[model samples]
Target: MTTTRDKLEMVLARLAARAEDERVFMGLYPEAARAAADAADDRRLAGVSLGPLDGMLVSIKDLFDVAGEVTTAGSIVLRDAPPAAKDAAIVSRLRQAGAVILGKTGMVEFAFSGLGLNPNYGTPGNAVDPARIPGGSSSGAGVSVAEGTSEIAIGSDTGGSVRIPAAFNGVVGFKPTARRVPLDGAFPLAPSLDSIGPLARNVQHCALADAVMAGEEPHILDPYPLAGLRIGVPRGRLFAETEGMVEIAFEKTLGLLGRTGARIVDHDIDDLLRAMREATLHASIAAIEAAEIHADWLTTRAEDIDPRVHHWLVRSSAVPAHIYLRMMRRRRSLIEAMDRRLAVVDVLALPTTAITAPLMAPLEADEVLYNDADRLILRNTQMANQFDLTSVSLPLPHCERPVGLMLVARHGSDRRLLEIAAGIEALLAS
Candidate 1:
């Protein structure tokens, strides 16, 4: 029988052994974590454990404010920033649920890129293949869980930050509706699109963590029946750049679901595809908003910001006000369009990433290569964010490496999405 302290010590030893390699945790609160574990053990002994997450070790992304610790958000610029005065809302909720937060994990600088290449703190390697890039901006968050340093990783997803890393590292990642989880203390990326979610071993773990973070009671999940489930696969641009292996994995999963009496429909989402493309032609709500939040720093301390992040921020200042306003108006129209299109289907399905994790060397060496890779990784996942949908990425079975099959639901459909994902997960495992 493993005690809470025993689990903590084993994880600590694993972290220590890898300390000399690529960085994963940006800050480790060993003393605090051990103390918290002791308390959880005491509660367990007294038969009064807090809840589902009592004694579970978790890692928060650097974007979250842990009281008394400066949030670096995977950047060097905020290292000297003042410590947080209070815990971020989710952190407080996690504490209330008796979750022991082990530390802060590294991330993409200012949560900018899908490729988690952090020059400031070394990027955490993919658990499947150390030489490939770990997806980001929640890069370390995914790696921490995948490598067994933590049971769950708390990360923010503006443009697939949580799901991308989860896909790369062979874990489950959930992105609830944008407004479902409060983002008060999280560092802003695109305020309109940023959402907090979990990277964990399975759908149930994500559900439990999400419930805690949302300030609700954690509940057991009953998997939805796969029979008669309506799953729509977008036909056009969604498949344009998909890699051979990803396509095979995805098609195979769809076939398996279909064999179990699932209704698989191909959707011609040309309007949705157009909306996504138009979003790129104008001011990115994420880039412009991120630029606004970091303007002062970019103006005075540009030297401290990551060049890739700085490149986008500096470019954002040139976007005309009229274009930004037009984009914002179009955003509402598109969200409505997506909702109507998805009304008939229980969920939309696609490969979480167009390509598998790429090697870091070429992307880092060339700006063009980096931007292209970033776009590919962010493409499919960004739709859910832009359309205000709830989504989850589940690892497909028997892939030589990890490949994620993403399932998306209409806005505010988080609970249903999770139940649906739970069903898919169970079906895949069988």
Candidate 2:
């Protein structure tokens, strides 16, 4: 039997061998992790187990509070900020579950962009192709899982942070309904849309971590039967601008599901999506809310912030309070409309991202390119956040580059969505 200590040692050694420029992790807790792993090994020897996550190597995004460490949120502006007085709620929960936390992973600045390029902390390259972008702001979280540095990685998804990285890195990422997991200790990007989730090698690991973080009892996942399952495909604007490979893979998967006793139907939501898009023409809810969170810093430390992040924050700060309120009210009604629309299907299926990870050089060198890619990368995943739903990104098999098939469910249907994802995962594996 491979002991937890063995796994921890292997991970630590691999991390040690990396070049200093590889910024997959912001910090590492070797001594602490060793202690935890040894403790877990001892428990196993004595025929005791804390839970499914016991002895697992876990990594947390930099935005999550780690007692006595400053939560940088992938920006340098907060480097001098006071250290957190205590660990974040999820961190405490993971520790209680006997998870051996490796360290804090890297993220996009302020969790604002999904491109994963962090000039402040060197960007962590994609696990599959080092030159390509490792989707973010949970870039390091996804890479850690893909590269085997962490068995599970916890990340916050405001607008596809968790799922985007998972898609690019070829792993499983789950974004529970916004409020399903407590947000008390996470740094806010958009308080109303922020959700804490996990990126791991498989759906079951995500489900286990999600339940633990949500303060719920973890249970065995019985893969929901794929036969007779109703999967709705919202095929309009969301399908536009997709890469050729992504489209081919998605269509093939749909065909396979259809042949396997699943019912695939066209479920149009373009009107609702269009309205939501028009409402945010000036600024997104995430940007507007983030602007408030960083208002003080925006004025005093603008130079310290990432230019891409600063630009959006500046634009969002200009949004009038009444307009923000009006958008909020309209958003609630749209959420209701979406929930009603989803009642006809078991879940919604779409490509997690429109394209696979693009090369980092082009995006980094050209601001225009960066902006366009960022918008497209975040486009589909943001829908769930805006409409208030639960979603997961499952990596597609046999793709040269990783592509994710996203499954979205109604609000508060996190467990059911995970169960369904597990079934699809097994089907694809077969």
Q: Which candidate is the best by lDDT?
A: 2
TM-score per candidate: 0.98, 0.99
Predicted structure 1, TM vs. truth: 0.98
lDDT of 1 by residue, 205-305 (tens): 99999999988889989999999999999978888888899999999999999999999999877777686677658557889888888988997898888
Looking at model 2, which ten-residue stretch has the lowest summed lDDT? 13-22
Off by over 4 Å in 1: none
Highest-TM-score candidate: 2
Tens-digit lDDT track of model 2 for 1-430 = 8999999998888888884766999999899999999999999999999999999999999998989889999999999999999999999999999999989999999999998999988999999999999999999999999999999999999999999999999999999999999888899999989999999999999999999999999988999998899999999999999999999999999988998899999999999999998888779999999999999999899899999999999999999999999999999999999999999999999999999999999999999999999999999999999999999999999998999999999999999999999999999999
